[model samples]
Target: MKIYETAGFPNPARIRMALAEKNASDAVTFVPVDVMAGEHRSEAFRAKNPDATVPYLELADGTCIAQCTAITEYIDGSFDGPSLTGRSPFARAHISMMNLRAENGLLNAVADYFHHATPGLGPDLETDQCAEWGEKRKAVATKTMSYLDGVLAESPYVAGDAFSVADITVFAGLAFADFAKVDIAEELTHLHAWRARVAERPSVAN
Candidate 1:
């Protein structure tokens, strides 16, 4: 398998963390895609993923999988390591629910603020921005941080007592917030503590 990604980017980092957690890092070859250079928009690259997004996974037979969640699911399911999504039916459903919540409320909101409000990537890439909407989304992301803090206060991880993909989503969201200059309030102590613990994991630390 060949994984195309821009190293250090938040979405790509999520997939990378999943790969590391699954202990399947060696199962695929990492191909660096230069998003800053607009390589993703090229026809050749677009043929693989019409969405023109990075952190794409291509199977040995040429099947391409886009989106971080889908790629993470593939990694966790196909590998022979401890599952990152969940082992049981209830666990899987809960993890998926929390993962979607983190993605919609935090990760996507921060991304909107970055691409619409700020000079994300550059003027060439960030056209048709809406600062007003971006500001609203920024506020949404901030509120989500508080909500997540409360969630962490009740559980060891984002989904439940065990580490899962939902935690990965929240971790990536927080990292993206830093890049976008969005601050997590100091009052969100539980969230901060959760982040500190997650950071200690080998998958996240590396």
Candidate 2:
């Protein structure tokens, strides 16, 4: 398998964490895609992913998988390791719900703020930015911190007691937040503690 991704990007980081958790990081070849240089938009790269996104995975037989969620699902299911998506029906549903919440509420919000409000990647890549909308999304991201903190206050993990893809989503989101300068409110004690715990995991710490 060939993994096309750029280091330090939030979505890519999520995939990396999943790979580490699955102990499959050494099984694939890592191909760096330079998003900042607009390499992902090139014809060669677009042929693999028309959406022109990184963190794409190409299976040995030539199947390409895009989107962090889909790629994570594929990785968790294909590899012979602990399942990050969950094993049972109820567990799967719960993890998916929390994962979506983290992705939509926190990750997407921070991404919008970065691409629309700030000079993300570069001007050439972010020509259609909307500062107004970005501001709104930034606020939404901030609001999500509180919601996640509340969730963490009740459970050890985002979905429940077990670490799942939802926790990975939130972890990556928080990492992106650091780059975007989106401060988590100091009052979000539970959230901070949860972050600390997740950071200590080998998958994230490295």
Candidate 3:
């Protein structure tokens, strides 16, 4: 298998962390994509992934899987490690729900704010942008942070006691928020504490 990604990018960082958690970093080849140079918009790269997103997984037989969540699902399943996606039926659903919340409410929201409201990736990539919508999504990101803080206040992890992809998603979302200059209120202590603990995990710290 192969993964085409841009190094150090937020979404790609999620996949890298998953691979580390699975202890399967060597299981596939890492192909770097020059996203800043608009290589993802090129015909060659677009043929492999129509969405032209980074951190996509390519199977040996030539199947391409886009989206960080789906790629992380494949990694959690294929590798022998503590499950990141849940082992039980109910757990799976719960984790999935939480992951979606993190993705849409936090990660994608911050992304929209960065790409639209700010001078994200310069004029070349950000051809069309809506400042109003981006500002709205920024609000959504901040709200999601508070929601996650409340969730952490109750459960040990995002979904439950077990560490799962939902945790990973929220972690990445917070990272993106920091990069986008979004403020995480100090009152969200639970969220802050959880982030500190997660940062120490081998998948992230090492």
Candidate 4:
């Protein structure tokens, strides 16, 4: 397998952390995608992935998979390790629910704020922006942080007992929030503590 990605980006970091958790960081090749150069939007790249998104997975059979959720699902199933998406139907559904929340409420929200409100990727790449909508999304991101903090107050991980992809998504979401300069309220102690613990994990540390 090969992962076409832009290094240090949030979505790519999710795949990297997932591989590290499975102890398969070196199993696949990492192909760099120069997103800033608009390489991902080229006709050649679009032929393989219509979405033209970074951090896509390419199987040896020439099958290309886009979207972080789909790629993470493949990673969780292919590698031998604790499941990132739970095995049982209920467990998987629960994890998926929480994962979507983290992605939509936090990560995507932060991204909206960054690209719209802030001068993201500069004027060349960011052709369109709505500062008002971006500010609205920033509010959503903060609200989601508080919601997750409340969740962490009762649960050890984002979804439940064991660490799952929900936790990973939240970790990456928080990292993105930091880059976007979205202030996480100091009162969110549970969230802060949970993030600290997650940062110390072997997979994330790697």
Ranking 1 against 4 by lDDT, winner: 4
lDDT of each: 0.93, 0.93, 0.94, 0.95
Per-prediction backbone clash count: 0, 0, 0, 0
For model 3, name the residue pairs that clash: none
Query: Tens digits of per-residue lDDT for model 2 on 36-151?
Result: 88999999999999989988999988989999999999999989877899999999999999999999999999999999999987888998899999999999999999999999
> Using Cα atoms with residue i matched to residue i, what is each candidate's TM-score against the true structure?
0.98, 0.98, 0.98, 0.99
lDDT of 1: 0.93
Superposed model 3: Cα runs more than 4 Å off: none
| Candidate 4: segments with Cα more than 4 A from true spot | none
lDDT of 3: 0.94
Clashes, model 4: 0
Once fitted onto the true fold, the runs of candidate 1 whose alpha carbons sit more than 4 angstroms away are none
Residue pairs in candidate 1 whose N, alpha carbon or C atoms collide under 3 angstroms: none
TM-score between candidate 2 and the true structure: 0.98
